[model samples]
Every structure is written in structure tokens, then in C-alpha cells.
Target: MGLNIKNETTHELVRRLAALTGQSQTSAVEDAVRRRLAELEQQQSADEEERRRRIRAVIRRAQQLPSTGRTTEEIMDELYDETGMPR
Candidate 1:
């Protein structure tokens, strides 16, 4: 099975696709649009997984931290520094 996108796309976009790839205008536009959509979807999935992992890590760390309390920002800063985010 395959997915189909239906809409009116600009001729200039089609032309640019053709120029960038060496394919016919229609084929270039179709391929370029398909490739870009696939990349965006894959990146979105990766980002969602990363976000979930971060949230879970935060939850676990919060449970372990002292009840006498540090701010959320402080906890996050500690995690970031520990992860060498500024490296």
C-alpha cells in the first residue's frame, strides 16, 4: 500500500525541484515532496521518542530528589550540566 497527497503545488516549486535533481519537472517535484515528507515524519517520530524519554527521566529523578525541595529549573540545570549539554 502507498499514500497519496493531492493538492495544487506551485509551478516554481516544481521547476526548482527539476533544476536541483536532473529529473523531469513532474518526477522531480513528486520525488522531492515525497522525500521531504518522509524526512519530516521520521524526525517527528524521533523527537517524540526523545521527549518521552526526557519526561520519564525527569519523573524518575524528581522521585529520588530530596523532599525538602529544589526548583524544577534547578533540577533541569543539574541534569543538563551532568549530561554535558554545554560541551
Candidate 2:
């Protein structure tokens, strides 16, 4: 397979990386891509963990509130009469 890298800067970077690492241009590109993908995946995993931590904190706070312990019908009685008309 062939890759078409039209950007001069990107082409130069790939060439430099290959020269520095003493590898072929294809190998340099492959290693760079893999390393970047690993970094992004790790970052995404950390973000997900932070999101879950926030959700758990919210749930814990909500649980600390007092419960009414009243059923829906019992509560509705406060707003409606026996004929189901609004009070």
C-alpha cells in the first residue's frame, strides 16, 4: 500500500523521524501513529473515569436528601378531590 503525504512539513517530519530512528519511512510513520493512538486512548479512558466519578458523587449527594416515603396516589390526594377534580 502507498500513502500520499502532500504536506511538505509532514513529509519532512516523517523523513526526519526515519533518519533519527534509523528506520524506513513506512516504519517511522507506523510507530508515530501507534504512539499517538495509544496516547489518545489513555486520555479517553481517563476522561471516562472522571465522568463516572462525577456521576457517582451526584448519586451520593442525592441519596443524602430526606425521603417523603409517600406513594403517588397519597401525594396526588393533596392536589385532587375524591372525584379526581383539582383541589
Candidate 3:
């Protein structure tokens, strides 16, 4: 398989990487791609963890709120009026 790099800067970087690591151009490119993918995966995992933490905090706060003694039907009617829903 043949890989063609069109960007001059990218080509130069690949060439430098190959020389620095004592690897072929293809191996250097492959190693760079693999490292980038790993970094992206780590970042995504951290983002997911932060999202979960925020959700858990929201749930905890909601649980701490005082509960209204209204029945389900009464709550639904109140919400409908607040939203100006048609009868």
C-alpha cells in the first residue's frame, strides 16, 4: 500500500520523525497516528467522566429539594397551566 502526503509541512515532519526515531517513513507515520489516537481516546474518556460527575451532582441536588405533597394529577395540571397547554 502507498500513502501520499500532499502537505509540505506534514511531509517534512514525517521525514524528521523518521530520521529522529531511526524508523522508515511509513513506520514513523503509523507511530504518530497511533499516539494521536491514544491521546484522543484519553481526552474523550476524561470528558465522559466529567459529564458523569456533573450529572451525579445534579441528581444529588434534586434529591435534596423539598417534595411537594401534591398528587401526580395535581402536579400535571399545574405544569400544563404553566406551559399554557390547551384543555
Candidate 4:
């Protein structure tokens, strides 16, 4: 099979690659482009899953909080008692 890709690419760089590795510009460019795309897809999938997990944790914490809230001073006193904070 043969690959034909036509776009703006550096001719001098292609010439140097052909001289060094005896492979055409199409082969080298195709391999490099495919690898880069694979890397991007993997990273994007991992990032999306992490974002979803963090959002779920935040939602769970919000759901556990009481609607009938204590005063700010009462909340601070409770926190201080729990942690043995200084007056």
C-alpha cells in the first residue's frame, strides 16, 4: 500500500530525513502524527474521569449537610471543641 499526503511541509527537513533514514516524508510524518493523536486521546479521557469523580464527591458532601443550620458562632465553637483550639 502507498500513502499520499499533500500539505505545506519543510522540503529541507524532509530531504535531511530521507538522507538519514532512507524513508519518505509521508511515512515519518504519518507515524509521528498518529502517535501524537493517541497520546492526546488518552490524556483527555483520564482528565474527564478525574473531573467527574471530584464533582460527585462535592455533590455527596453537599447532600450530607443539614438544612437547619446553626449560627456561625455555634459552628465555630463546635469546631474548636472538636479540635481543642485556643480561645
Candidate 5:
């Protein structure tokens, strides 16, 4: 229901935000905290963005690879028979 900010600088910043935005101090702090928490929980940081970029690049590269008309089973049939010995 309440928060106690002991730091004068932090208190002043909250007061400044409240005045500048015409919001209550609680609303200012709540907005700031909620935005940051959402970012943290949703992985909206730069590192997360870079990681997603890398994963996308990998997916793109994989999709660009040439496809073989033969399946793995077909290749195995060429290399080995029903007895599991090399042909």
C-alpha cells in the first residue's frame, strides 16, 4: 500500500517526475517500476534482442541449406542391408 524511499536524490527524482508528468508520486513510481519489470520479465533488453537476432540468423542459414531428395532411411539402405552390415 506504501513505499518508503530513504534516499533524498531518489525522492527528488520521483517528485520531479510527478510534477513533470502531472501524476501522483505513487503513479510515477508505479509506472517506472511496472515498465522496468515488464521489460525484465519479457526479455526486452539489448542482450535478448541480440540473442534473438542470432537465432534468426541461424534459422535463416538452416533454411538456405540444400535439401536432399533422399531420406535418411534411403541413405541407410544404400550403405547397409537388413542385417546391418555394410553393402
Candidate 6:
């Protein structure tokens, strides 16, 4: 496949990377792209783990709350009575 880099800065970076790494420009770009993809994947995995941790923490907190064992209807009735609403 033909990879035509149009951006001047990107072209310069590719050239510099190739020179520094003693590799072809194509190889440099490919290596950079692969490394960035790996980094992004790792970041995404970390973000997912963090999300799961937060959800677990929330579940644990909710579990610690006292449960009256009252049914939904019973709770609503109590609230209505407190508000002086007619049953």
C-alpha cells in the first residue's frame, strides 16, 4: 500500500525517527503507530479496570446501608402519611 504523508511536521518526525533509530522512514512510522496503538489499548484496559473498581465500591457501599426489608408499597405508604396525603 502507498502511504503518502502530506503533513510537513509528520514527514519531518518520520525522517528524524528513521535517522535516530537507523531504520527506514516506513519502518519508523510503522513502529510508532504500533507502539501508540499498544499504549492506547493499555490505557483503555486501565480505564475499564478503574470503572469496574468504582462500580464495585458503589455496590459495597449500597450493601452496607441498613435494609428495613420494607416492600415498595409499604415505603410509599409511609412517605405519603408523613406528607399528610390522603391514602
True-structure RMSD, every candidate: 12.9, 5.0, 2.8, 10.5, 6.5, 5.1
Model 2 CA lDDT for position 16: 100
Q: Which parts of model 4 have CA positions greater than 4 angstroms off?
A: 1-9, 12-22, 68-87
Q: TM-score, each model? A: 0.52, 0.78, 0.84, 0.53, 0.49, 0.78
Tell me the tens digit of each residue's lDDT in model 5 across 5-78: 79999999999999999999999999999998998878767778899999999999999999988998999999
lDDT of 1 by residue, 4-60 (tens): 445446667776778888899768867877999999999999999999999999999
Candidate 2, residues 1-87, lDDT tens digits: the string is: 777989999999999999999999999999999999999999999999999999999999999988899987899999999999999
On residues 1-87, what C-alpha lDDT tens digit does candidate 3 reach at each position?
777779999999989999999999989999999999999999999999999999999999999998887898897886787666945
Q: How well does candidate 4 match the true structure, expressed as C-alpha RMSD?
A: 10.5
Quote the positional error of residue 80 for candidate 6 in Å.
14
Query: Any idea what lDDT model 4 has?
Result: 0.77
Whole-model lDDT per candidate: 0.81, 0.96, 0.92, 0.77, 0.92, 0.93
Highest-TM-score candidate:
3
TM-score: model 5 vs. ground truth: 0.49
Could you tell me the lDDT of residue 32 within candidate 1? 78
TM value for model 6: 0.78
* Model 2 RMSD, rounded to 1 decimal: 5.0
Q: Supply candidate 5's per-residue lDDT for 43.
A: 76
lDDT for predicted candidate 1 compared with the true structure = 0.81
lDDT computed for candidate 3: 0.92
Worst ten in a row by lDDT for model 2: 65-74
Clashing pairs in 6: none
- Count the clashes in each prediction: 0, 0, 0, 0, 0, 0
